[model samples]
Structure formats: structure tokens, C-alpha cells
Target: MRARLMEATVELLVERGFAGTTTTLVSERAGVSRGAQLHHFPTKNALVVAAVEHLTERRGEELSRAVDALPAGGNRTRAVVAMLGDHFASPVFAAALELWVAARTDEALLAAVAPLEQRVGREAHRMTAAALGADESRPGVRELVQATLDLVRGLGLASTISDDSTRRRRILGEWADVLDREMARA
Candidate 1:
């Protein structure tokens, strides 16, 4: 029941920004009774915030699982970049974006999300470094990893506005090349 409501909330958040995803809409979409929904999440903020956290955790786990499938040699750098890009461009990311945008102006939402965002950011960095075989103890490696994450996040934002697959692919390829060179230097 909790999972259903959270999943529905994430879907609605992606389809219709934060302002449009209401508790009533979520209940109907989840096919859960209003009483049950309210019992689980008493307020809209409570429901949406919990939903965003749930999706964020799921997205991170999915990325971690997919990392195992990444190519071990050859254009592995490119593969890693592509994998990270795809993860950021997923629907769950979009839903998180909606929550982030709303949280910027809503104190209550911000209070709930700021810590989660920080944790997610740290985990993403850790995972990206691990996937790329990057050792941050070396000079410049930490910055390089951060740059890769920032670049992919920007790509994700661009994707939300339009169909950016072609351009994003090209950019990721170029970035992969640069990352390979930089990582080698570091």
C-alpha cells in the first residue's frame, strides 16, 4: 500500500509538476482508498516528500545494479558516462526535479528534502567514482568526478525541456573522451 502510493505520486510528479500532484489524485491513481492514503501520509507534503525519497532511493539502487553491466574494457569510460546520463534522465529524476523546484520555495518541503538531497548527492558521487575506478586521493580526481556529475545533471535538465538524445549522446561521448584523458593524468 505504501509502495503503491509512493509510485503513483512519483508518476504524477513526473507527468504534472509538484503543484498538480495532489493527495486526492495520488489516492485515485494508486487505487488506494482515501482513508488508507491519509492513514499512511496525513498531508500532501508528507505524501509527496515520502514519495520523492522513495523514488530517489530506488533510482540510486537501480544505478548501482546497472553499473555491474557496464563494459569492463575498451570504451568503458564512454559506457560509464552513458550509463550515468541515462540514470539522470530517467522519470524518477524528473520527479525529483519537480520536488527540488518546489522545495526551493516551500520551507516545509525544503526542511524535509535538504538532507535527503545532500545524502543522495554524496551517494551519487561515491557511486560514480567507484564505477569509474577513480581514486579521489589523487590530485584533481575529486574535481573530475564532480564535473562529470554536474555535466550529466545539466544534461538531465536539458532533457526535461526537449528531446536531447542526439545532442546528449554526442556530448557524453566527448565528455567520456575528456574524462578518460583526465583520469589517466590524475
Candidate 2:
């Protein structure tokens, strides 16, 4: 039931934005009573935050599986960039975008969302680092890994507003090339 409610919340958030995702809508969409939803999540903030956390964790698992499936000692840079592009274009990121926009104006929501966002960001960083076979002990490797994430995230944000698939592909390819060259120099 909890999972159902969270899933419904994510769907509604992606479809309707934060303003449209009320407790009533979520309960109805989840096919559960308001009472049941309230029993599990006492407030709208709690419910939305839980939904974001749930989706983030699920996406992280999916990313991990995708990473694990990549062939070893090949062009990991291109593979990682492609995988991240798919992830950024996903509904999970759309839902997260809604939350981020809402949180900017809503203090209560920001308070609830900040820690979860931090955790998600950290997990993404760690995953990117691992995918790149980054040696964290190196001075600039970690920074470069973080920059890759930032670049991918920026590309994802642009994609949310426009059909930038061609541009995104080009950027990813170019960035992968740059990263390859930089890593060689390092």
C-alpha cells in the first residue's frame, strides 16, 4: 500500500506538477482511501518527500544494474554518458524537477526535501565515480567526476524544457571525448 501510494504520487507529480498533486488526488490514484494514506503519511509534505526518496532509491538501483551490465575494459566513458542520458530523460528526473521547483518557494517543502536531495546527489556522485573507475585518492579525478555529473544534470535540465536530443547527444559525445583526453593527460 505504501509503495502504491508513493508510485501514484510520483506519477501525479510528473503529470500534474506539485500544485496538482494533492493528497486526495494521490489517494484516488493509488486506489486507497484518504484514511489509509493519512495513516501511512500524516501530511502532504511527508508523502511527497517519501515519494521522492522512494523514486530516487529505485532509480539508483536501476542505474546500478545498468552499470553492472557494462562490459569491462572497454569505452566506459561513452557507456556511462549514454546511461546517464537515459536516466536524466526518465520520469524520475521529471518528478524530481517538480519537487525542486516547488521547494524553491516553499520552506517547509525545502526542509523536508533538502536531506533527501543531498542523499540522492551523493549516491549519484558515487555511482558516477565508480562508473568512471575514478581513483578518489587522485587530486583532480573526483572533481572531474563531479563535473561530469553536473554536465549531465545540466543537459537533463535543458532536455526537460526542449527537445534537445540532438544537442544532448552531441554534448555527451563531445564531453566523453574531452574526458578521455583529460584522463589520458592525467
Candidate 3:
């Protein structure tokens, strides 16, 4: 039931912005009783926050599982970039984006999401570094990893308006080459 509610919440968050998503809609979508929904999540804030957290965790786990398939050598950088790019362009990213936008104006949401986003950002950085086999101890390498994440996130945001897949792939490919060179130099 909890999983169903969370899944419903994410779906609604993507289809309807945070302003449109509500406990009533989520309960109806989840096909769960209102009483049960309240028992699980006492407020709208609690439900959405929990749903986002659940989806984020699922995304992280998916990345970890996919990391094994990342190429082992020369093409590894491109593969990692491509994989992360796909991840940022996923529905989970859209749901998180809704939360981020909503949090900007809603103080209560900001309070709930700020720390969650911090943790999510840290995990993304750590995962990207690991996936790239990047040595953050080396100078400039940390910044490069951060840049990669920022670039992909920007690309994802752009994708929200239009299909940027062709341009995105080109940019990521070029970035992978540069990233390889920089990592080698570092």
C-alpha cells in the first residue's frame, strides 16, 4: 500500500505539478482508503516528501545496478556520461524538479526538501565519481565531476521544454572526451 501510494504520488507529480498534486488525488490514484493514507502519511507534505525520497532511493539503486555494465576501459567515460545523462532525463528527475520548483515558494516544502536535496546531491556526486573511477583527491577532478553533473542536469532541464536528445548526445560525447583528458592529466 505504501509503495502504491508513493508510485501514485510520483506519477501525479510528473503529470500535475506540485500545486496540482494532493492527498485526495494520491489516495484515489493509489486506490487506497483515505484513512489508510492518513495513517501512513499524516499530511500532504509528508506524503509527497516520502514519495520523492522513495523514488530517489530507487533511482540510486538503479544507477548502482547499471554501474556494473559500464565499459571497463577507453569508452568508459562516454558510457558513464551517457548513463548518467539518461538518469537525469528520467521521470524521477521530473518528479524531483516539481518538488524543487514548489519548494522555492513554499517555506514548509523548502524546509522538508532542502536537506533531502543536499543528501541527494551528495549521493549523485559520490556515485558519479565512483562510476568514472575518478580520483577526487587529485586537483580539479572533483570540480570536473561536479561540472558533469551540473551539465547533465541543465540538459535535463532543457529537455523539459523540448526534445534535446540529438544535441544532448553530441554535447555529452564531446564532454566525455574532455573529461577523459582532464582526468588523465589530473
Candidate 4:
């Protein structure tokens, strides 16, 4: 029941930003009673925050599985970029983007979301480093990994409003090439 409510919350958030995702809507979407939602979540902030955390954790797990499934000793950089591109283009990213925009002005939302964002960011960095087979012990590798994430995130944001796949694919290829060259130098 709790999981259903959270799933509904994420769906509503992704489909209709924060302003439109009310407790009533979530309950209706989840097929749960309002009282049940309140019993589980207590507040809209609590529900929204829980939904974000739940989705992030699920996505992280899915990412791990995808990365694990990649062929060993091949072009990991391209594979990682492709995986991240798909992730950024996903409904999960859209939901997170909605939370991010709302969090900018709402202190309560920010307070709830900031830590979750940091946790997700850390996991993303760790995943990218692992996927790229990066030597984090190296001085420049960490920054390069972060830059790659930043670039993919920007591309993902662009994809939310428009079909930027062509440009994103080109940038991913170029970035992967540049990253490979730089890592070779390092």
C-alpha cells in the first residue's frame, strides 16, 4: 500500500508538476483512500520526499544492473554514456526535475530534497567512475568523471522539453572521445 502510494506520487509528479500533484490526486491515482495516504505519509512534503527517494533508489539499482550487464573489456565509456543518456531521458529524471524546480523556492521542499539529491549525486558519481573504469586515485580523473555527469545531466535536461537526441548523441560521442584521449594522457 505504501509503495503504491509512493509510485502514484511519482507518476503524478512526473505528469503534472508539484503544483498539480495534490494528496487527493495521488490517492485517486494510487486507488487508496486519502486517510490511508495520510496514515502512511502524514503530509504532502513527506509523500513527495519519499517518492523521490524511492524512485532514486530504484533507478540506482536499475543502473547497477545495466552496468553489470555490459560486456567486459569493451568500450565502457560509450556504454556508460548510452546508459546515462537513457536514464536522463527517463520518466524518473522528469520527476526529479519537477522536484528540483519546486525545491528552488520552497524551503521545506529544499530541506527535504537536498539530502536525497546529494545521495543520488554521490551514487551517480560512483557509478560513472566504476562504469568508466576510472582511476579515482589519479588527480584529474575525478574532475573528468564529474564533468561527464554534468554534461549528461545538461543533455538530459534539454531532452525533457525537446527531442535533442541527435545533438545529445553527437555530444556523447565527442565527450567520450575527448575523455578517452585525456585519460590516456593522464
Q: Which candidate gets the maximum lDDT versus the true structure?
A: 3
Rank by lDDT, descending? 3, 1, 4, 2
Model 2 pairs in collision: none
lDDT of 2 at 160: 82
Model 2: per-residue lDDT, tens digit, 39-94? 99999889999998998899889898899889976677888887898788778888
Model 1 residue pairs with clashes: none
User: Per-model C-alpha lDDT, please?
Assistant: 0.91, 0.88, 0.93, 0.88
lDDT of 4 by residue, 1-186 (tens): 888988999999988888999999999999999887898899888999899889878988999899988987658778788788878888888889989899999999999899889989999999888888888888898999999888888988999998998888888988888888888887
The parts of candidate 2 lying over 4 Å away from their true place are none
> How does candidate 1 fare on TM-score?
0.97
TM-score of 4: 0.96
**Candidate 2 similarity to native, TM-score:** 0.96
Clashes of each: 0, 0, 0, 0
TM-scores, one per candidate: 0.97, 0.96, 0.98, 0.96
| Model 3 per-residue lDDT tens digits across residues 11-120 | 99999989999899999999999999999999998899999999999988888779877659979899889888888888888999999999899999899999999999
Put down candidate 1 lDDT per residue, 105-141, tens digits, no spaces. Answer: 9999899889988989999999999999998999999
Better of 2 and 3 by TM-score: 3
